[model samples]
Target: MLNLLVIDGVLLFLVTITALAVIEMRNLFAVTMLTGVYSLLMAAVWTNMHAVDVAFTEAAVGAGISTILILGTLVHVGVKERRREKSLNLSALLIVTLTGGALIYGTLDMPAFGDPEAPVQTHRFQKLFDQNVGKVPVTDTHHVEAVAHGAEQHGGEQHGAHEDEFHGHVYNTVTSLLADYRSFDTMFETAVILSAGLSMIMLLRRRSDEEIEAATQRTERVDPDTIKTERMDPKTTQTVRVDSPPGSDSSGADKKLAAEIAEAVDSAEQIQHDAPEETDKGDQV
Candidate 1:
């Protein structure tokens, strides 16, 4: 009993620490890992309490499937939480404190651990179970050795009798309760878990190849780094010449337009020189 208590205490302490670490953690990846660790610790605690079925469920669903789902969610949502200023919310703190106090108070009325006179053990359902299936036999090492010796002496006859005794009945009470007596509840629980898993798969499923290809096509075809844009300065003027293909002949009209443009430029330069000479002649007169 002391050993069980010690183990339970240790597991609970680990669970508490993990929970705190998860709450304090900003990184979603680390928090997801800590959550799985916390679930595993709780599963250990449940197994120590002899609730093996619950422990198995917790380990598989909480630690295994749940961790996988959270990881998938992180892929889409990113693994880092948005940074925000942390502030203590007094209302939330008050609510949590009150809820914890209420839970502790509720447990005060409950029976001690493994108490035979507890409501669960003394309940009508338990009486029915005992009457129908018989209480599970507790066998020690000496009892097991004696049974083995008897089985050897009697051979097939003893083996047949033992089989007949446990026929059509589950030896484990918890298994019997979940599998036989409360089968509908168990079935519904399984359905709920299945639905949840399917929903998660739907939500976290990757895009189809066609959708991915379409998205790729929508992106810019040209690389921004490879593109060069030349911006001309407003203060500078540049003349661009359009060169025809080497074998292409220039039209007569194009040649005539080019000659007229060159003649106009030359005339403008001659008038500038004649103005300077006329000004010098007027000064001499």
Candidate 2:
């Protein structure tokens, strides 16, 4: 019990921290990750509270789908988060808090946990669930391992005789509430997930390499250095045509003469144009 309480307290603390982080984080990706953490903590709390069905749905929808959606958004738009107005939105917060306070006050008359008179674990709740949840046969107690070579398998006919002696309810109420009672909610949730997936595909699907190469070629025409830096072609031992800034002659032939410079450039151009395609390809690379 103490361990459970400690876990619950930790979950509450983490929930608050996630709230603060989501509010304060400048990076949208960090905000999304913190939201996922919040969902995980909530799932843990649901598991601890004996609500296995709720825990499963929370873990799947909140942590799994929510995180995926947020991550998709971050991937396409980048992690930048726009800052909210500096002025406090106090009026809106005050109205919300006041309404919440009123709701909390109304909960004062609610039954305490594990109260004997509470309807949660009673005949009435069972009857209500039975009326709504179309019955499925008791599957969990069907000795799932009985199909394998075992004593139970040998006594398959006897299994029916023993079932009545130790019967368990097949219609779990919480599971029914999630799948049947709120079926539309789950359907809409599925729709939301589909929408997110479609949006991400439409938005973030990267341009093809051919398209990227075309764009790069365009950029290079406007400004050629945008392409890759040149390097020496090892095959033919040719130094690639890498640009050097004016007046910074690394060749050390500057003082030789302007005539020598023009002649060398023309000769180099001629060699480049006349070279075999094999050598030229290596030089381009």
Candidate 3:
């Protein structure tokens, strides 16, 4: 019991620290990781309290699946949380404080841990257990004696005689309650988890081929008029012009550019033609 208490205390401390770190963190990715750490610590605390089923669910869903989903969301929303002016809202703070106080006050009236005389233990469920669920075979003599002693205290001579035959349906009451007595509750909880996973998958799914094609078409439809030439150096006054395609609409600037290009090409041909004749005349001299 001492070891369990120490473990629970350490786990709780770590959980608190992780929760605070997550809240203070500005990076969404870091917050997501801290939240997973918080869930893992909570799972450890639950396990220390012997709530294995709850611990397993917390570890698998909260730490594992939830972290992955948050990461997927971060891919779209970005990893950095937007900066906001830090100011405590008095109304929100008051509401949270009252809610927390109410919860703590409510727990004050609840029974202590493992109280055998608690309402739940002494309830009509005991009769149901005695009728439907038979005694679990006890290998430990101490446990058997304890069961016999409890039966005698309850004034059940028959229970004491057949204590071994009148044990719980399952050794673990939590398993019995979740899997048997409240099966429908468990089923609905499972359905809710399944629905949440499906929703996350749907939200994070890749764009379809049709959507991608439509985006590509929109991109291709960009106006050619929006295209502009890079600014030339100030030392050069001449502007570079694009050669318009044949039979395409041409501006006055383009037509002048085409004419200048044609004249330059003719002058280059004339120079080439005279070059061979000049070479022949030099050879004769």
TM-score of each prediction: 0.57, 0.49, 0.56
List, residue by residue over 1-285, the lDDT tens digit for candidate 3. Answer: 788777777888888888879887999999999899899889988888878989999999899989998998899799987778565678878999999999999989899877888989886567555445434444443463556566557564334233434356487776776777678999999999899879967975555565455446542332222122212222212323244322233345544544554565567678868886553455442
Model 3's alpha-carbon lDDT is: 0.67
Q: What is candidate 2's lDDT per residue for 74-115, written digit by digit as tens?
A: 787899877767646888789989999999898788778658
Q: What lDDT does the true structure give each of the candidates?
A: 0.67, 0.62, 0.67
Q: How are the candidates ranked when ordered by TM-score, highest leading? A: 1, 3, 2
Instruction: List pairs with backbone clashes in candidate 1.
Output: none
Those runs of model 2 whose alpha carbons end farther than 4 Å from true positions after fitting are: 128-173, 176-285
What tens-digit string does per-residue lDDT give for candidate 1 at 77-151?
999988674566688889999999999999998999679999887756543465253332444323544466664
Model 2 RMSD, rounded to 1 decimal: 18.8
Which pairs clash in model 3? 135-165, 135-166, 135-167
Error of 3 at 148 (Å): 34
Scored by Cα lDDT, where does model 2 land?
Answer: 0.62
Q: Mind sharing the TM-score for model 3?
A: 0.56
Per-residue lDDT of 220 in model 2: 26
